[model samples]
Target: MTAIITTTSSATDTATLEPGAEAPANAGEAAAAASEAGAGAPALTGEHTDLLETLARHRFFLRFTTKDLTDEQAAARTTVSELTLGGLVKHVALTERRWMDFVVRGGEAFANGFSEREAEFRLVEGETLAGVLARYEEVARRTEEIVAGIPDLGAGHPLPEAPWFEPGASWSARRVLLHLIAETSQHAGHADIIRESLDGARTMG
Candidate 1:
């Protein structure tokens, strides 16, 4: 079995953003640490700034899809697939959290198992739309904090041993950020469809 290394504690010192809050003062510094830097990480460059802006834009769309929705409406499956507005928000939060963990802890991030991947897609009993959105905001804030503190976007770790990943290949922190943006964007589109189906709401004109 692969060893599980804990990286969640790294974010303990970072400040949390409230729901719909803007990125913190230190947001968008993309690069893994060559050594611990925390709040003292270097200022953002054009690339990192652009990356964060694009990510924030897509994130806005994703969250906006759930606007004005009741828990029941958010949980309703509008498409043939199991996808729902609340579920998409929850899943995106989970995905972002895990990838940030990988950035800090590397391949050991997967040690938690795949069960979380499935469960986050639905609002389990007693779960609310407000709750999931709050969690997503927390995750997003953590991502910004992690990215802003790390010192080397060029730093990489070997890919986890999975069928979906190429053997022996690795990804830099930059790659991971791009992947996050893409993942969020894709899901945001799916969310648009679901929202439109639910009440003819579209993310765009």
Candidate 2:
């Protein structure tokens, strides 16, 4: 369990304590403390700013693919994958939120968002396109907060043990941000094809 925990109460009072126990490791925590600073300040320059911009632009393109879509159209699956535009939007938004939460709270963030795999990619009944878009906006705002506030791009925790991931692999905050951008861009492409199939709509003007 490679977790970087610190007291939320104070910055100068930083320490990596064992889970459920309180003990300060002054020397080891020095790097960790510096790594977590600027959580409340603006993110300017460096990789964080670049990643934020890239993701924002890609997300804009993704949203554009679904413009002028009706609830029926958004929910209609145009591909054999059984993926709807609305569902893709939901997935990207949830993924961004989850990755950003990881930046703040590490592996624990996964439990906060989607619990079931099917629910993530499925558009349930009574789910309005407007409502999902609104939720997506909320997630985008939080994603921006994460990219702007978290101090260290290099800071990371070991990935949860899983066969899907390399054993003992870890993802730096930077890598996580890049992954978000990649996923968003990829889904945006999917949305484009789905939109084109739905009513000959295209993201490219």
Candidate 3:
């Protein structure tokens, strides 16, 4: 799929870098910003709150690693791997959007194409760190809205045929949410290493 770019430069945008602030100073602040960044969505409790909060915390860590970075630095590969900080942010956002579509629309969502999978990991001409960050924030907000408003987490669809997935299996919205959490967390670690190598900054101690 061609990467979509929908960016908003507002300071109040969720998980986005503020106008003057580079990024959240620490994980706590990042988490707090993520929580407070939401609009007046109805209050959630129990499993919904727990899952969203945990996911938000991890998302904060991932985005926090990109503090004070230039577009050149964000796109540069620090290690032998092809992964770059900007690329991870973009990739994760795209993946999350795809999965969310699946959560609502089922396996048909994948039929469009993943032709841009490789490009998703690199910054193309005109793609900037701030632009990608803004796009990610948009995707994140949409995710929060979708999950929060959905009536049931148990609603599910059959898995698309893939070697990585079990045959004849299905996944509920809850399972998809958990998978997104795991995927984002894993990529956040990758981004942390990339960030630390690029500079001396660490997302956590």
lDDT on C-alpha atoms for all candidate structures: 0.71, 0.67, 0.75
Candidates in descending TM-score order: 3, 1, 2
lDDT value, residue 74 of candidate 2: 87
Better of 1 and 2 by lDDT: 1
Candidate 2 Cα deviation (angstroms), residue 52: 0.4
Write candidate 3's Cα lDDT for 20-53 as tens digits: 3344454445444434544454567777766776
Write one digit per residue (lDDT tens) for candidate 1, span 96-174: 8998899999999988666787678999999999999888867876777777776778898998999999999998889
Measured with C-alpha atoms, the lDDT of residue 169 in candidate 2 is 88
User: Judged by lDDT against the true structure, how good is candidate 3?
Assistant: 0.75
Error of 2 at 80 (Å): 1.6
Reference-based TM-score of each model: 0.78, 0.75, 0.84
Model 1 regions lying over 4 Å from their true place: 1-43
Flag the better candidate by TM-score, 1 or 2: 1
Most lDDT-accurate candidate: 3
lDDT of 3 at 6: 15
For residue 45, model 3's alpha carbon misses the true position, in angstroms, by 1.3
- The TM-score obtained by model 2 is 0.75
